[model samples]
Target chain A: MSPFLRATLTIAAKDLRSEFRTKEAFNASLSFSVVILVLFSFAFDPTSEQMQAISGGLLWLVFSFASALSLNRSFARELQNDCLDALVSAPIPVAAIFLGKALANYFLLILVEITALAVFALFYDTHFAAQLWPILLVIALGTWGMTVIGTTFSALTVNLRMREVMLPTLVYPMLVPALMAAMTLTTDLMNGIPLGGDNLLWLRVLTGFDFIYTLLAMVFIDIVVVG
Target chain B: MRDRIMYVLATLSAALLTWNLYKIFMILPDEKNQGAIYRIVYMHVPSIFTGFTGFFVALAASALYLITKDLKYDAFAAAVTEVSLAFASIVLATGMIWGRIIWGIWWAWDARLTTMLVCWLIYFGYVMLRRAIDEPTQRARLSAVVSVFGCVDIMIVYKSIEWWRTQHPAPVLSVRDGGGMGPGMESPIYWNWLAFMCLASILVMVRMRQESISREIDSLRRMAHAY
Candidate 1:
């Protein structure tokens, strides 16, 4: 592998190992999502037909909150013992640091999202046995879209005061378009609506959002880190 | 000289604004379908135009700040974004009034409206982000990057919302789509936009001046070890 790719993968692996040992963020995000999902059931009859149609929106909403929960701390971990200063001074490109964190967050979020979705399904009793692959594809695109924005903004707000508040405020607004596309696709697929028609456009939109933002974030990460 | 220019621009904006209101309320004929309620479009379109222009300028200024490592561009971006929020608020309010009457609702989650709203939220957070960081270079660098993220999100939001619905009228100005309105009908909106643009420019300059002075004070305080 090229040095850039190697550095990126190394950073990703390091984050994964540290996070796996603690699972602090993982447990927090998952339990928060479960609480939110359970709380939502009280607000509406999850067994009703209406819930089946709108559960896609609800599921992603839970995941968005879950995303905010974990991303806020993604960089805070490096702040301990001035690890961030050391990392920035490292020989690796800052973009690698960013991509590494983003990739790690992507993997963590997808795990959280799948778990959350299963919880949502169990609560709402919705099924998508026939469209599993496409649902996973949409989840990847949509989660990647949010992951790019959330990861970048996490770094942006990591040093700011009240960053726990600032991260969500900064991250959620950008997530709207992505969340909307994700919700729409998930709902349609869960309803047995196939892709490759009007749905094709939404798929393109979600993918395009992921592609452009990832590229933009990589190009701009150095500026954010002040490297 | 600067004060003179400010004086001239402010007066011109006030005079043109009065004239545009006069033209909209008295000179222009009522719409065939909606009557006088449609007159709200005059304010709605111009406010959004000025706001969007400010936002676009912010994007440019932010990019320049990134490339040059200059704090002035950061100040300019901050000024433009705050001024743009004022205009965006006007657009939302006027749009609400217009939609209530013409579309029989106070708000519609159409493409244009959704983008305008989401754009406003993102930039508002940009301003907040500026407040949370105190170091000069760090603030400038981070907020500029966030501004780029905001601009990119605007396009994504617009595109994603387009997939759902698009109820806002097509571009009616002669500059766009070859003029959706009749020849004479479009001129007032353009006139109003020019007026508002001048007004927004004044706000931006004043804010920039404040920013520079405040930054100077911040550095002096740091030199004195204030905190």
Candidate 2:
């Protein structure tokens, strides 16, 4: 592997390894998702038809918040022992640090999302057996879009005092379009609606947003991370 | 001299606002479907245009700051961004009021409004990000990156919302290209747009001066410490 890829993967692996050891972020996010899911279920009874109609929205909400929760830890880990400063002074490319974090957050969010989806399905009594593939496609695109911006903002806010509040404020707005597209696709799939021209347009938007933002974030991350 | 220009611009803004209000209330014709209440467009649409201008300039300033590493560009970006948010608030307030009067609802998930709200949140996030950090240089650098992304995000929000509106039909009114405005309404829109632009520009200039002064203070403090 090239040096850039090796550096990126090394950072990602380090994060993943540490994450597995403590599981602090993953556990916090999963429980946070559960609480939000449960709270939402209470607000709107699951037995109602309205609940079914908005299940896609509810699921995405959980995913978005959960992802935020996980991403807040992306830089918190580096802040320990002044590791981020060390990494910055090291020979590793800045883009590699960003890509590695994005990748790590992406994987972590997918785990949280999958868990949340299962719980959402159970709570809402909605089945996605037939629509699983399309749902996964939406999740992948949506999560990638979210992680790209979220990880970058996470890094940006690491030095701040109210990082917990800062992360969602920054990430959530950019994630709206992705969330809308993902929610719409998931809803249509759940309703057994085919991917018509209209649906495909949203899919195109999701894909386009993911591609554009990830590239933009990669190019700009060095600026955010470095002085 | 700089203060004198601001005074002149302030006077111009006041005169233009008074004239635009007169034109909107007395001269402009009512919409065929919605009477009287449609006049809110004079406020809402012009503010939206000005906000767009503010945001676009912010994007350019941000890019320039990043490239040139000049505090002036950073100050300009921050100043205009705040001005843009102020205009965005006007858009939202006017839009909600109009929606309430015409559609019998204060809020609707219409595409244009949703996109505006998203854009507002992103810039609000930018401001929060600025407040969170203590280091002036780092804050400016990260903020520039965010402003650039914000500009790009607004475009995506526009396109996504436009597409989303197709699936869920929204009230469409366009003053541009003679699509919605009729007769006397056209000229007032032009004048109001120009007026709002003047007002927004003046606000940006005043705010930019404040930012520059603050930056100078910070640098002066650092120099004092060095002594």
Query: Per-residue lDDT for B92-177 in model 2, tens only?
Result: 99888987887789988876778778899999999988888787788889889889888987887556545665322243345333
Give the CA lDDT, 0 to 100, for residue B215 in model 2. 72
lDDT of 1: 0.86
DockQ of 2: 0.80
How would you encode candidate 1's per-residue C-alpha lDDT over A59-124 as one tens digit per residue? 888988898888888888899999999999999999999999988999999999889888877877
Docking class of 1: medium
> Would you estimate the TM-scores of all the predictions?
0.95, 0.93
Query: Candidate 1 on B112-210: residue-level lDDT in tens?
Result: 787778888999998898888877789888888888888887766445444655778766667645866755788888898999889988888899889
Which pairs clash inside model 1?
none
The runs of at least 3 residues in candidate 1 whose Cα sits more than 4 Å from the true structure, single-residue gaps closed, are: B157-164, B219-227
- Restricted to chain B, the TM-score per model reads 0.91, 0.90
| Predicted complex 1: DockQ | 0.78
Q: What is the lDDT of residue B3 in candidate 2?
A: 80
Off by over 4 Å in 2: B166-178, B216-227
Q: What is the interface RMSD of each candidate, in Å?
A: 1.2, 1.1
